[model samples]
Target: MTAFCATGAFAADYVPGELVVRIPPGGNVQAIHDAWGTQTLEQLSLRSYVVTPPAGVNVEDCDQWLDADSNVESADPNWITESPEAKSAIIIVAIGSSTTQYTDQGAFARIGLAEAHQYSTGQGVRIALLDTGIDPSHPVFQGKLIAGYDFVDDDADPSEIATGVDEDGDGLTDEGFGHGTMVAGVIAASVPDAEILPIRVLDDEGSGTLASLIRGIDYAVSRGAQIINMSVGLAFESEPLENAVSDAEDAGALLVAAAGNENTPTEIYPASFGQVLSVTALDSNDVKASFSSYNEEVDVAAPGDGIYSTYPGGTYARGSGTSFAAPFVTGAAALLFSAGTPGEPGDLAQSLTDSVVVVDSLAGNAPFAGNLGQGRLDVESALTGYLAEQATSVDGAFRPYGVQFFASPNPFRGATTIRLSTPAGTTMPHELEIYSLQGRRVRTIRSDSSDRGAWEWNGLDDRGRHVSAGVYLIRSNAGSLQSVGRLVHIR
Candidate 1:
């Protein structure tokens, strides 16, 4: 277990995408697939940059194990080990990595000052992060945050996010900085009932590689993060990032991502993936943010620009961008999951987007109507559906009175059949568009006829490929008539 000081970024730049481990690792014949790594320990590294060992194939006797972080953590069963024949596997979660709340007398939230006191009030859940480790001495997080893994080099304490000491020789985080600290506050604040994981995915200077994201996501899922909010994004997609998302999905966790401030329809990775919930920004008027991207590739929209949230030092900020919107949904999701909802992340996404309030016409207001999604988020309505079950009106011809869609399989598996109909006899030749949860148009099962009827996706996309396990849509159209029905693709 040599204290390897990793200075450079991961050999591979991380982007979010599908994780596929075509082959299994050695010794662990049951090791079917790793949501975060393909090669298991060979690909996984601890904060100390130490190689992890395969499950049941313990490296306690190996020299690398001896050199790893003295407090290095491992998944309970180690997802990198075997397959219990689970369609959706279990994973560890790193909620609020450290909820010690060291800043406010041992129990204080770091952001969302307006709701600061309510941060951990009654979450009954946890807030996990991966940034400047926590100050266990802080009262708010002390005795909270439960447990976490320190990925920083040479540091026995996983709580230290920025240390003036480069004890491990890693060139990063020589000084104390708070990146994940702010992120944790956004998700955990105004909800004292939740916990914080502080997984430490990023180092000081707001920079991280795919390796850390993978390890952090894996650790969080394993620890049980039902709502994993990522207030971050990358330019391109990476295999490791994709695997991280997959792992979280397997654990039935929602990966809430920031839609980016690029202000263009072209998307950012991870948030642009099919499994994620891409949140855009909408002002108080329910208008799309100028910086928010718009295109057919966006799923949902939320209050982003000029939004406020928690930061380090117990202070609040008026931070803007889709980064904060991701948390609105993340926190709401936590509320739902803790209250017995948000079952599968893939489905949670559809629930949030399809039922969102259609105010000010997000499509008409934004530069690109397709990317802005369904206007703004209505927390109570979104979670419990105050208006979901009741739409404005379907009228004759199944025309979209405001913004309502149709789908199949209330709780279906792969290839759930879907059929949409108009108000008896509406004829339209519009294409049937199928968009993934992340807003990417995956399969367009065209309805060549100009009449109402049924069309089968066969659970396959236009690319002739079978998508992952999650929620999907079968958008119907017949000239002026349109409807969006929800579907599920199971393995």
Candidate 2:
């Protein structure tokens, strides 16, 4: 059996000549190994084992034996994986925190920090950041970053390493070197009081195997992290990786991940997992970034373009990608955690969704809105949106409002179906009107006695021309009773 380690930043892909075997629960581990002529290299858990073939045997032979074994639930080669290469596109125009180079605009201001800070500074909340490691001495993360395991070097030092090579071929070598630091900086800037648990899964070359990522997830859960931010991702799917994410969510961690920077719809692991809150990126114009990958799994959008944050050596630099956007939500989740919000990750996700002010341009016209999770991340609104939702009226009045109105694909890109439901057989004058947030009536979506039916809005106004991207209010009236719901339209 051979132990593998990369010597340089650009080391040969070390495909471990071993297998990760997950035995059925309560299955006899000794019996299974005895039948396969393999010896356990490490016991990840009672049911999960990393095993290697005998000295003279072929690895494929051992795999065949395990595949045919009824006692083995799942077994496969311990595949070598790497961080999403697109993050190498992170363009750093200037470095260091010097007043001349640094923009005064803080990362917090982009996401409405003034209002969010009033509610929570993420005090007492712990967020686990899984990335290439972090610089321990960065001022922004001085007391907040708690070092976890270094899966690469297998040591206590989780410092970010640079291979001095453009691992992702973006013309910049070691572009991912201080990636973790930047991500941590974003979280710190958003929630200065929140605790950060840094986990080093990727190596100096911005590559890590599935095992490392899974280990990081397990550690994040065990360390009592309320939020786990995965700024890195792998393109291929791995069962073990998916299971680890699920386990983290089950253990009460709000898992957030980058949606990848390939600018394609292809899903990246962990982020693509159902348990994770996949985040996309937006530019200064509040428009979807051309490089931000979009898909159905995207949960929320955040400012990722030209984001300035802390870097190594007591400096700061600007970077961009979904990798940066994810931490915004992570910081936001830390606020929810610090507030002791009731419910699991799903509830937290829903709260963030409801809070978004809505980037209407992401509606039906662009393919990044409805299909991509919910909407943009409104940190302040998220902190207060839940309470506001519970109260039907601003004064907390419980009026008997009769009709129920809802807009499907609320943050729609092209068109949406609005449904107005009322008590059956108690028909009154039914009307559905679409109005801009500015109080101007755009169109009358419906005006009939039909209590329950679906009406389509082709993203146009009464003038029959497509309206500009913005929030639209749907008002439903039956007799003297009225109900209102919000619909977001995007170009």
Candidate 3:
């Protein structure tokens, strides 16, 4: 058996004598195998399959031969990938304890998560987490997980388990254990209400093949995941992987990946793809971490050093790597979806880039300048700015609400006029209240007489303090009549 290497200086190490091929619809798999003298190994998806060439046929030759066949759409070697934090040690802080105490970690404050939560907790978004399996029973994931599968073991349960053997030759057994739990923990911490779909692509050793990763992507899309978080990456690009990413994007799912941990300009697969939101890591000082890969492909940065999150066995730990950094962006995307920011994946990606905190001028980051991406993530700014932009671009259609309730001059900088119309001959007292997107009541106005229906809000809360600029909801109740309308406030 001959080894296959990808086309690059830092080529990816792939399996020997194995090829992943895609067959067009209605193509005869048996005929292709008979013509090429190959054996079918596994069916990855409806149109993709894993096959082994006949004895003495090199992987490269088999790939070329399959590509030339009329039935085959594409063929490539099944490349290998690893978790970014596969070798890093995790410092376990607490076990079987309430997760509320650790919610105030520095990473949360650095990214303005507390402020961001005031707008949205990712109520209606589902994130597909593809990594080493997760601890399904972890306290942080209570009521946060949806149905998922384990491609490695070909099972329905995608739970993390410890294997005693050392897979990476690092003299430590199960170094990759708890990796998925940590990644899931980060997302749960950022968006407590967002549902997570845990797809186990990598094993406990943090090693997975391109075939499994592709299958995981297909599963996530089939399960209706809005965002896919991939903390694992290949050293070199593969056509099969890129095709999977394109399919996911076409299905309206946003892909977020770690930039890799080689600390070089070399691009990594999936992350290097233009459709993906490639994320790098930053320390507490707002500078790039020493081990994070950086280049023009990086889309954003997040706190990844000494980051604390959920661990296996219902515990919590602190670790660092670009793997953890990618989930922060994933969580932020969930927030945008929950806040009703309407658009495709590209629009959401633009919103995130436009709201980043430019760290080029920060100390210790002068060397990386444009290579570190837009900057460290600021979740609050991303949500508010996106909401405001959406508000201004619309025709102010009252599709979401009834015609009896509406706001004029939406996207107003200072204040806007709100009007509520009641049925004729109604004499019950009416009450109108303003609320943030997260459902926090901001102001309340009451009319004792039924003759009045218009009120001008000065963008102040009940305490008479000015609220920050963002989207707001106006709800009114008059006995049995209730109406809801949306408005935008700009600073």
Candidate 4:
């Protein structure tokens, strides 16, 4: 067996003398091994196996040889991927006060998370976070985590731990520790109600092989993950990894990945794949970060500079990289899924791309205009536009009201004007009712005067008390006149 190195500098791009291969469903494994002078090391799946070639056979040559065999479905070297975060980019800060409460960080406000939350908090959605694992016991993840597996250690507990040595020779031990926790924290801050499934693929040195990544993705899909967040990247493309991505997409899971932080136009695998939603990093001013990679493959940009999020030992830290930027897009996806956005993952991705706040016109991003993707993420716009589109698509064939009913500033904080448009000769008394999502009527506005065409809602209940922020349904029924509209109230 080839010895694997624990240090990043000594690690090879692909495992020597080892190949990941997929055989026909019922192919004879022994016969194929004998023909190729190779031995199966381990079976990854029913059709896939990690095999070692005979002593003198060159690994790359054997890979090509095996790939040409009709019995072999696919074969390739086991490529390695590393966590995209740079050690210097991270700044860990100890939580000074034990009573420090969890709140949305500045990045949240920059991405319009508060307004987005008024629409959907990602309730019932599951995000599979594939990284170096997480500090599961952290206060930030307290009721927000689900059962996860650690492919690195082949264990059930996917918690972050230090190796006590600087494997990367960067003078910092466990440099990648708490990386998963921070990524999870970003998702939690965006959608606190979303369930995070922490799958540990990368080791403490922030390095993992393509084999582990493929397995992790399969496990996430099998566990019913609605969204998968991969904050890791590899420079070279791997066929098996792409296959796994395709499988995940086919099973209805949306994959979001970080465009590597190399500050170059070079594409990174998984992120460069057409199926995945590639994310780039943006600074507080909406300018692209210095370390963030920009390419045509990037799907969207998000605030990643000095991102404050959860760390190990019940503390919070600030970090920066495309690694952190990817989660914001993941969180946005969860929010859309939770709000019952209809359609496949592709449709949802398009919706998000369409809703981006265009940053290309900004002076800071002028040089990289078309390479930065559609623009920076705007969660509020994504949700609001989706809701509006849904409202417009509703079956409006039957017009009982003989008028059009709508609201200006549909998602309002204090008040919104409900407008009713009718034909010049048409005048009818209407009673507008406001009900919570649970179908309980909260307030009623009666219009006995036919001349009135609009009414203002002060975001108050029928008892003249303020109602909690949430989605509300507005319906008007006067004899045969009936119309319904949706309203989002924010506090």
Predicted model with the maximum lDDT: 3
Clashing pairs for predicted structure model 3, backbone only: none
Better of 3 and 4 by TM-score: 3
Specify the poorest-scoring 10-residue window by lDDT in model 3: 1-10
Candidate 1 runs further than 4 Å off = 1-42, 45-123, 130-144, 154-176, 359-364, 386-491
**Residue 4 of model 1: what lDDT?**
20
Assess candidate 1 and give its lDDT. 0.49
Query: How far off is residue 162 in model 1, in Å?
Result: 4.9
What's the true lDDT of residue 440 in model 4? 89
- What's every prediction's RMSD, in angstroms? 17.5, 13.2, 6.4, 5.9
Q: Model 1, residue 55: what's the lDDT? A: 39
Per-candidate TM-scores read: 0.53, 0.71, 0.82, 0.79
Top TM-score prediction, candidate number: 3
* Candidate 1, 1-491: lDDT as tens digits: 12221112321332222121212112231232232222333344222122333334432222233234333222211112100101011111222334332223111121122332211132456655545455444444545576777654524455545446553243633322443444455555544457767665544434444455566677787788776666555655444456557667877777777777666665665777777777777765567766666656567777655544344454443445666566666765665444332356665666667656775454448346555766566555544441223222233344443323444543244544455545545564346787764568888765546443555566677888876534454566565656665553434
Q: What shift in Å separates residue 254 of candidate 3 from its native position after superposition?
A: 0.3
Q: After superposition, how far is residue 196 of candidate 1 from its true place, in Å?
A: 2.0
Question: Global lDDT of each model?
Answer: 0.49, 0.71, 0.81, 0.80
Off by over 4 Å in 4: 1-11, 24-31, 86-104, 168-172, 396-491
Our tally of clashes for model 3 stands at 0
Ranking by TM-score: 3, 4, 2, 1
Q: Model 4 reaches what TM-score against the true structure?
A: 0.79
* Backbone clashes under 3 angstroms, per model: 89, 12, 0, 0
